[model samples]
Target: MKKPDLISELNTAINQNIIIEKNIKEIIDMSFKIFKKLFDEFGLELEKLCDFKYSSYYSKHKNIDLDLAIVKYFPKKDVKYKEFLEKILDTLKNLPYGYKIRKEQNDGYIAISQETSSKIINYRFIFLVRKKTKTGYCDYYNRNGIWQEDYALELTKSFSLANKISNGTLYKVKSLLNYVLKDQFKYNYGCDAILITWFYEFFSRSLNKYLDNKYNKKEKELDFVNFTKIKNLKKWFKYNIDINNLYYFIFTKIGETNTYYYPELSFEPLELFEGITRYSVNTNTFFKLPLSYFSHIKVFDLRNYQDVRLIQEMGGEEYGYSKKAWSKARDEDKRYFVSPFIISGPFNYAMFKKWYVLTSNSLFKTLPVEIKKDLNSLRQRESMEFLNMTGHNWISSYYAKLKYLQPYFDKKYPLIKERDLKVLIRMITTMVDKTKQSDWLLENDN
Candidate 1:
């Protein structure tokens, strides 16, 4: 597509009023009631409101999906937090499901759920109230000195508990709520200060550069510019915002006119966290809140909005134990590899310690001497390297070691795909059944 044409298309796309999901009304109403009640009681002031809006989008496979969100932002206030939290808890606890409270940083979050019924899956009430003393001093402190940034506070709480809530379900639910809350509270607090600041600065300074000739079209005299410029917008915004490509899938999927462009908007939370990180809850009360929210709202295909590519990306290079295009992709230049093991040696032997036993005992008879000697020599060096890097190597470093062993498997076990080699290594290290993964390598050996 030509630059001007793409610009015109994007211009029209942004202006179009996409439909918000019908069932979302209930969720929005619930959120609004909570926001309003909290604002009134706590003295937090409301600044702006955005009812949910949507836009047209086409998938790589040419599918369509609806995107919807509403935002309610309020001005920064004195936020007389302690007394405010008491009243906030009082309001949520009285709701039918009864409320559960968890201490976060110096503040307390009260989460309440409505029991699953014919209509509602359940409702979750979450609050973060930081204590603001008359003195201008604020740090992460609870009863003790237990406070961190909001994200750090959430991470600390997520790991310190034990609950049956699966990480997959938690990630999905949290992703949705994070989006909603980000949009709603961004302007209110400091939720989107970075993005908004960058946007203003860009338009304020380089207003003409963004308003290039592409925006001039006979069909629409939009005071707005093209969304194609959104790419540059992303690049400039990154100076103030640090979002990763993995979580940028939400925006790319939302603005899907082309299969190519991926905008790195600074609006996602999961981008702020790594996938290896898990979310835990001390009590069922906190876990159930997120579960109830997602379970109740099932009108849309949750998977449709979810990108499997994103799952792989968020999991880092070792996700699914698949290694393809890593050789060239790994280096100081990219630094995409989870660790140096892909380039290290000893970690590989540890991964296949059992397989190494099988190789040394059974396959050594059939394998050539050079391959065996090379494997042993590389293993020793890499192991020492890994040990030097860290006092102790974890299970993950085994992936790096496994890749070095690949050449031995290739010359001796020529039938396996390089992709399958990585899978086999992960399976072996994970204690997966050899019989089941036998199909993964040396298929023609039998």
Candidate 2:
């Protein structure tokens, strides 16, 4: 698994058209031409108001379908930046390609779309403002003549809870507090602050009750506790918990599950307050869009593709939800977790085999034998769990049934092979590793 050998194999795979590398390159070339034309027309006008640059060059290299650019504008003494934004939107609308634009109040981006060869491609140009306190910048919202960043930062500094509290339990506490305090605060003092205050009180009372139940016969000296009575609680909370980690969890969860597609625009509306934030694990930064800006943009249905439609006929949609099914689930419950399946199981298995070949050349070689054994054990356990959940025995009977079903299976139960299960585990674990090291917002002027 030398680097050179891996590169050669990858090149061979591309030459054979084993993946969608050719299609990706064609789209990237098309997107670049559109981006360059826009920059040529209004780059100078944009520069006069703020720092403007392209932000999705790295994304083009990945197997995604969208492109993005960003403009960072600092609030000036008396200049009207909103007017400039409107001018940009007007220019986009006037393009010969018939680009459609979508804008939102207090939002950080303008979404644009165009159709080419019967397929729609989406582009986003995010607007960012410089932060007042530091050299860094973030998306801000205007509230009562004041600009405020994400409330997560403020809430992180206000809560004092035991380090032993699990993240799952803390999330439930936050949800409960938010619901109870919504009517009382109503954005006057910020919902997060109100939630944190009451959450601290609730946690203290719960802990006291648990302690009393455990030591019913024993006489123990205890002092009455409250959030206000605790000295240096904010400092303790800051020292104990990493805010970045908490924000990362919240951001990733929202980006994955909390989205709705606008029927008119054919894309999801971007809003920072509505949990549309993207967190880059590598840089520890949060932005207003997902790593793949067009991931949730559904201009065409998955069934429209011939290959995907055939797979869906074979119970692809039943094995896991499609993008449309996922959106429908969100409509039913915004908090529902839906994992979308667009590619077929066999195709995924092939890709996973290729990925395992590439990584085994380097990463697997570096791990200790014991760790490798543990990973194999984990792969086995997960495979069994998946089989049990999917109700697939993966034996002779399963294969016989699959043959009888032909290209279509009963929608009630989907099935897969037992041997492909290991590859699936490898694929998921590798993706998680890559996400942790992803530079989703890499800027490239060239």
Best by lDDT: 2
- Expressed as tens digits, the lDDT of each residue in 360-382 for candidate 1 is 24423443555445435645443
Per-residue CA lDDT of candidate 2, range 13-62, in tens?
22232123456547646655665576567642121110001111112122
lDDT of each: 0.26, 0.32
lDDT of 2 at 17: 24
Off by over 4 Å in 2: 1-18, 21-24, 39-67, 73-81, 105-108, 131-446
**After TM-score superposition, what is the CA distance of residue 378 in candidate 2 from its true location, in Å?**
45
